[model samples]
Target: MDESLSHNDEAHASSSHSGSRRGGWITFPFITGALVGLTLAAGGWLSNLIVFLIEEFHVKSIDAAQIANVVNGSSSFFPIIGAIVADSLFGSFSVISISSCISLLGIIVLALTAMLNSLRPQPCVVGSELCQPTSTLQDAVLYTGIALASIGLGGTRYTLATMGANQFDKPKNQASFFNWYFFTLYSTTAVALTVIVYIEDNAGWRWGFGLCVLTNIIGLAVFLSGTRFYNIDKPQGSPFVGLARVAVAAFQKRKLQLSSESKDYYDGHDGVKEGIVTGTLSNSFRFLNRAAQKIEGDIRSDGSIAKPWRLSTMQQVEDFKTIIRILPLWSTTIFLSTPLGVQSSMIVLQALSMDRHIGPHFKMPSGSVIVIVLLSTAISLTLIDRFLCPVWQKLTGRSPTPLQRIGLGHVLNVLSMALSALVESKRLKLAKANHLQPVVPMLALWLFPQLVLAGIGEAFHFPGQVALYYQEFPVSLRSTSTAMISLVIGIAFYLSTGVINLVQRVTGWLPNDINNGKLDNVYWMLVVVGVLNFGYYLVCAKLYKYRNVKGADVNSGSADSEK
Candidate 1:
């Protein structure tokens, strides 16, 4: 559980695991292969969910968009809980295995809904006054399937990423595994968007949902096959408990004078002398130093604290401080993700109304439009690693720090919003000209430019945020660190859902038929949001200091700038 002894633990694990010849590069294929299957299943159903709801459930377009956002929010949000459970109750392997089976059951339920007409409402003809509304019973059936699927998908994704990283000891090997992990994630989602969505659009919904079910089964199978080879970490109590204890102890001893001498503080267990390894207590967040300041009766005749809530180790207080310092930077990411959440649903609606033809005979599915973002991100990731980072290093004499990379992403995110507004303005004008038609005269491809920009922005920010959190967070919260991005994204999606509801109530910008509404105004609104967020991000980046500063790390220069 000690951060300083992580390498020693890994070394111990390696020697013990080596006897059985388990847990190294040997488990890589199975994990990555499982990630592929799981991601495919998730994207196949989730990506196409809005269309499915509107087409089969007799839900209104705007209502379906709201539902999609909510589902996406839940899917993003649940991973943190999954990570916590993995870290506190069960190991990653058990959590993933159980979650995968849950996902498979959920997908099977979804497939059943598509296959059985009785489970869904009567299909409504578009723009028809005689269409039947979905009954409460029908709605319940659909929601049950969605809730199950969302919970299942949420539990697996990031926990799987953490599990994959745990398989190796070397940072270099761990880094390589992450590269392949993300590549598989994006690439498999792309496959789902194109292949599975095409089947739903062309063949039958039943077939597409059935495919998801198959992939879920295969993913579970592949993951379970690798059980003998994983380096599973057992639960070491709740990390959050330590943080909470720091806050409680600080409050309880608020009246106590702060300590100046090193011996006054509790240096963790093992009876190691004070100031030997931990040095002195941090000066920042000085009020919290009371938590570590020893008082009579706080410690037993032995070294450990008698009342855990009244006193904490110096390391615990420092870990709590680390979270507080990084929070401002983390807040900036919610706004970054919020605009994309709104944009995602809006773009799908735009694609549904516009011309979707590809020359002679092919017509693109509305959901498949998101594949543009995925493909662009994957390509941009390659370009950033191969060309942009090197060019940046040459130009600046140092590699870009995580903050710098995230800053670039903010700029690009703002630009993407502006482009989205402009493209929507054009689409709206064309929609007015063809108001009587089912589809607008404009090509759906017109929306591609904005989507590609958003994708490029993600390529910069997503990994940057991941790296920043992983490097900056307390080692005890490693699983939680990766899930923090998901937490940001989840909140963003939920915020977007709230924003959409507010817009619906207040303005005519996002009507059921966007052809008659001012969706451009919505994009323009997001443009403003992005600009404000980017400014806030700049302020946070300016004031932020990197905690982890190895000589060869990209962040070392930025850390030095703080001096």
Candidate 2:
């Protein structure tokens, strides 16, 4: 299948190649520059946002973490909306361009909140008992800035990625583009985590946010400069609408008798269809097959759909079934990320009360501690792609399946939670010994092993989910497949927020001062959650069968061949 597709792409590229054409390697620098600048700008403010909320807004530590999680959820969730808008109304280029400007405006607003005294509560010393809480108006302004920034950042990032991938015809070129794109994204983000976050901690929030604003502007400018070089695809109506039609049609036709004859179904007009189901629908989910069963007024003289809500094509019905079959597996990933969300926030809080000093001169920012996870993920991803995968294939005679990878990730995540429990228990004991002092005697570096393990888990699961969705989803929904992972992550963050709130309400494990509470118990709870979630994943994996076996094989080949 891959050989055939490669031949087709080569033929298409050779015939289409011309100096006058818009897309190719020529647009790489401009697009990559825009990506770097925007990603750097996003990370600059977002990476240290919990610290900003705690220091500037006089919010409680737990509340700040919750707010940050909400912000992260919003950022992750909005991409699906952006992708929808791009597919249904505007093109990717327009959406990306407009979104970048919005990000610039949002960052400018953020910079103002940092610069102006009126937008936030008065600064108070850390751990002060008499710190003033923010007023309603102050909260509104701060939330407005965060909302805009989240919307803008979410709108552009993934849309820009799709646009970059669309620029090349060859799979290899598109694959290479993604490699560089992620490299730029992660590397620039690492810089922001370190350099930009250090500036925010040392120079001032105003300076850090000001740099974000500048980069947003530069990134927008660079993206716009590539106007003539991009291969812009026109908006096709949302594939989701088609899926909805299938569900509606299926329900409306629920009473209709099912049929096995090819002539009984609407195979579509002029042989134009969305899936491999040309003459018949799949036997599974036979109730939906009635959706394609011919009835009066279902089609017009031209063979186009007359009442689309009442009747769908065979392909649409099959496509809907494909999604239904894959949903359980997708659901298991939400819990996979929920624990990480909790850990991300909890680690920052832990770092704040631990020894962050190195050699007694340089104090690491609490925010910078998360960078260890990022670095660990990056390093682990490289090793998995370069070394581990090959070794596994050589020893096993086949590359690891996505389910295998995700299962490994689940086990690692559970182990990381257990490790986190141990670390926190030690810290809590030390805090008790010291009478719950502001800073414990424990070193912040003690958190690294758990974080590194969590990062490695992500290296396995996140990409595995993405690859799974892309391979399994119907052709019409291919563009939206990548966003499915984002949706999972977004839901995970929100679920984590809910979990934290529940723990706070029901248990004394989480309090205003974590040192005084049983934070280790929270990690132990998450470990249990992880263990249960992993069991659920295993069940789902055992029940699920690959819908696109050929595609999966190709993906495995690509993974194996990656050097």
Top model number, TM-score: 2
Quote each prediction's TM-score: 0.93, 0.94
Give each model's whole-structure lDDT. 0.84, 0.85
What's the CA RMSD of model 2 in angstroms? 3.4
Note each model's CA RMSD in angstroms: 4.1, 3.4
Q: Least lDDT summed over 10 consecutive residues: which range in candidate 1? A: 554-563
Model 1 RMSD in angstroms: 4.1
For 1-563, candidate 1 gives per-residue lDDT tens digits of 13313544455566745433245677789898899889989999999999998888767899899999999999999998898888789978888998898888888888988998888777666667567777787777788888888999999999888888787766656666777787788889999999999999889999999999999888889988887667667787779988999999999999898868988888776433333355567899999999988899988887778999998888888889999999999999999999999999988888999899878798999999999999999899888777887798899877778888789999999999999999999888887887636598889999899999999999888878877887788777755776888999999999999999999999989889888899999989999989999999999999998887663244322221210
Point to the candidate with the largest lDDT: 2
Candidate 2 structure quality by residue, lDDT tens digits, 370-432? 888788878888899889878998999877888888899899999999999999999999999
Model 1 bad stretches (over 4 Å) = 1-21, 125-127, 270-276, 551-563
Clashing pairs in 1: none
